[model samples]
Target: MAKARLMVVEDEAITAEDIRSSLEGMGYDVVAVAATGEEALRIAEKLKPDLVLMDIVLKGGHSGIATAGELRRRFSVPAVYLTAYADPATLAQAKLAEPLGFLTKPFNEADLRASVEMALYKAGAEAERQELIRKLQEALDKVKVLSGLIPICASCKQVRNDKGFWQSVENYITEHSEADFTHGICPACAKKLYPEYFDQLYGKGSGGTPE
Candidate 1:
């Protein structure tokens, strides 16, 4: 199997080198290393790495969270944050970006490997789920088209189906679709079908009065 491609974004030179070494040791292919958020975004778009290891605090105005958000929203790239700070406020902000994982700084090789593997697996599972839902919706749409349908009669409130069978409107609709029927009166239908009863309950000028 091919190695999972990764892009590392860290401004600290020593930290970046250490992360690159650790990721390579874990059998991931480090496609590119970027010290700034802008460079990270550019490399991510062009190279299309399988995952991004981003440091939350960066040199430029665009922080790791901002870059990760852009990558996810625009290119659909999965990202895991590698940060020194894990304060509640920072974590809350990070949650808004929807990172696959967050690893605090000074992490060992085991933490690095585990976080990366879990992030990739989560991303893969989500993609599979979306594809399955899409296929199910397509199948349902085909079923609707294959089933015979009928138009309702305006005067009698009945349906004339393709088989030349005339049925009650509700019965015809319920047969062909997933709709659950609940018997209730719409204001206009109530007024038209039971005019005397409507007038008795609510008086002449009420909006529910028959047309």
Candidate 2:
């Protein structure tokens, strides 16, 4: 199987390299690393990583939470927050970004592995679900099922559409549904309309095949 691609968004160079080393050891591809929220967003736009390991506090105008939100909105990328500060206020703001997982600062290899795996799994499942919904909607859109009461003329055998305009049965059905028409003369109609060739064509029976 292909390794999952990841991006590290940490302002500290040493911490970012540590995270990258851990991820690479865990069989994940660290595609890029960014030192600021703005840089993270810029790299994410191009790399479109499967998951982002983001530092919640960074030295930039845009916070990690704000950058995470933008990554999700623009590229459908999910995030696993890395933070030393897990205070209630910071967590409250982080929740708005809907991060898939969280790893406290000074985390071990096992903690990193767990958080990254869970985030990748959830992101994949959600993407599959969205694609399934899109396919089902497309199928429903393509199907045209006719229903409800129809107003049709008894003598002419034509139908009245929603606009109150009368049309032939074949034309109405063809327009309102996936059905198409192929013209053929039935035995009774053929005998009645062309008596001269009835016996030769139908073998003198009510519903006979052409000889």
Candidate 3:
């Protein structure tokens, strides 16, 4: 498996470096470190890290909660909030951002590792669930298309779709499904359409092998 990429958003330079060093020591790739919410958003847009370690309080126009919410809404990136204030009011505001985990100040390396691992696992599972749902929806759509009673012209071999427009069989199927077509002429069609080239094309009495 690939290493999980991480971003750290902290206003304190020493604390941010400590977090970066700890995360890197734990085998995660610390892609970028931001000192403010604005920098976090800019870096998140460009790096698209797997997860972010966001400080709940920042010296900027956007708070960590607001930044995390923006990240989730725009880039689908999850955050693990780090803060010294774990009061009821702070927790209430933090919940609005829907973080993956919360770590109080002075957390140990073991706690950090556990939170990061669990968050990454949940994110991966959610991504897989979404992919499965998309595939199932596509399969259901294909079944609906093929199960319907299609109107086809017997002479022209054209199909009439739900929009009441006549289209070639290839065109209709291609539009409705993931199937594609490559042109080919069967022996019967070849004989009727191009008699002069039929014998040459089929290798005449040479058993379908050119002389």
Candidate 4:
């Protein structure tokens, strides 16, 4: 499997460097380090990193939650929030972003590794689901295209097969295609083709037989 690309968002220089070093040691690719939410958004859009390590409190116009929400809306990127303060009020706000995981400050290498692994797993599952849905939509789109633009002879009412040969519409329809046909005669055709039978059946000009 390919290594997961990560973006670290932290305002503090020491903390950001530590996280980057630990991520690299864990076999992850640290694409970029951002000090502000605005900068993170810009880099994340360009890099399309697999996961974002977000700092809940950053020096920027947007908060971590707001940035994660925007990224999710724009690119469907998954975020993992980090904060030293795990107070309920702060966590309540962080939960709004629907982060994959949360890591408190002063975390060891093991904690970072576990959090990053879970985030990558969650992101991978979501990516697979979206890809599946896209493929299904593509299949449906192809079906719709085949359903339209069918070439047929309007006058003879014969369907033109893929080989450009015009065959009886009934036989053409009954080919390997999914459609099934039941043979029937309409009132107009019955009257024109078998007028005597029509008269006998409907009492139309029955008094005068075919002379």
Best by lDDT: 3
Worst 10 residues of 4 by lDDT: 141-150
Instruction: Sort the predicted structures by TM-score, highest score first.
Output: 2, 1, 3, 4
TM-score of each: 0.70, 0.91, 0.69, 0.67
Residues 1-211, model 4: lDDT tens digits: 7888899999999999999999999899999999999999999889998889999998969988899888887878889999988999999999998899999987999999999898888888888999999999988765521355658888988878778998886677567355767777776677788877886656765554333
What are the clashing pairs of model 1?
none
Considering summed lDDT, which 10 consecutive residues are worst modelled in model 1?
A: 142-151
Among these predictions, the greatest TM-score belongs to 2
Q: How far is each candidate from the true structure, as Cα RMSD in Å?
A: 15.2, 2.4, 6.6, 11.2
| Greater-TM-score candidate between 3 and 4 | 3
Q: Candidate 2: where is the Cα deviation over 4 Å?
A: 205-211
Better of 2 and 3 by lDDT: 3
The TM-score of predicted model 4 comes to 0.67
For candidate 3, the lDDT comes to 0.92
For all candidates in order, the CA lDDT equals: 0.89, 0.91, 0.92, 0.86
- C-alpha lDDT of residue 44 in model 2: 88
Spell out the clash pairs found in candidate 3. Answer: none
Please rank every candidate by lDDT, starting with the best. Answer: 3, 2, 1, 4
* Residue ranges of candidate 3 with Cα displaced over 4 Å: 145-211
lDDT tens per residue, model 1, 54-124 = 99999998999999999999899989999999999999999888999999988998999999999999998
Model 3: per-residue lDDT, tens digit, 143-198? 63455688999999899988999999888998887777888878877778898998
